[model samples]
Target: MTMLRTMGADRFNYNVFKKKMSKEPLYPTQECSYKMRIEMLDSYLTNQKTVDVSSYFKPGHLVIVDLRDPSTNASLVIALFKIIVGLFVKQRMETGKVLLLDKAHKYLNSDPCSARFTVSMTSLIRQQQHFGIRTIIPTQEPAVVPDAILDLVFFLVLHCFNFPTWMRNLRRHISVNQDRGESEGG
Candidate 1:
């Protein structure tokens, strides 16, 4: 009879070797190594080729909602408004790179009822613009936001000049097209 000896088994030696190798660092411990990895990820995203939004969304698949109601709950109102605007911005960023906000005066004006809501909304819009997001705000109320902020708007719709002074102020930044042909050409 032969005595069983496990001490020199090849399986045991293999396991011991793996355990030793696992304890050794596979990567450098320097902070710069970690930073370089993050930078690579960011560069990948920035350099990604642009794709058509139609590939992701079907034609005529857009939803628009009005959040001008004063009776709606503040939190619910803000959340829904954010969802709509977020979708618009996402689509714009992916495809068009531009968005038009019609009747923006309603939000920019300082109404006694929706002052907080307007302030928060304006802040978000401004932040989005700062990040290379293009927004066209067509509003008759020139006093709502500072002139510098309004200057970012590339297009303006000047119609029915109920306020001549406001029209004049807007004219400084945007050209007024009284003729429909001129507006269409623009």
Candidate 2:
């Protein structure tokens, strides 16, 4: 049995050696290419669960927040924001650079004030900025965010605004116009 196994191994090795020596490539050959066809399986599979937000924020990493849609459950959103802010604060304490927050106003809305999560998240944003951590907030509705928070933004990206009030407020920080001539004039 050992001798037979040795012979089989030797034969396999010789076949591989001969194939390498041949002009044809080892993979995707004319004779064996049909066997390499990948079939798409028609089977039901469970949807992938959403990732925990905590794992996303590393020390000294820049983050972009897109909270365009209002949250169904405000409490969960607030709790998540608190955890992120805490992580950023800890990271900043250890390292001088801060974790930046982008598009913060959507999650930190001020109107109605019924959403405890939005209020808490807004407070956290303010606190993080107070500790000398940089935060950049981009929003279409600047009025929804507090003036104190808006004042801290070092950089501003003003896209074309449809509302006059938004246009007026944006003009104070950055230039906004329909045409090149108007932009230069403003």
TM-score of 2: 0.44
Question: Total clashes, candidate 2?
Answer: 0
* Winner by lDDT: 1
Tens digits of lDDT, candidate 1, 94-125: 33344456665554545653465465455655
Q: Rate the local accuracy (lDDT) of all candidates.
A: 0.48, 0.47
Candidate 2: where is the Cα deviation over 4 Å?
1-72, 92-103, 111-132, 170-186
Please, what is the TM-score per model? Answer: 0.41, 0.44
Which segments of model 1 are wrong by more than 4 Å?
1-60, 73-76, 91-94, 109-134, 145-148, 171-186
Top TM-score model:
2
Candidate 1 pairs with clashing backbones: none
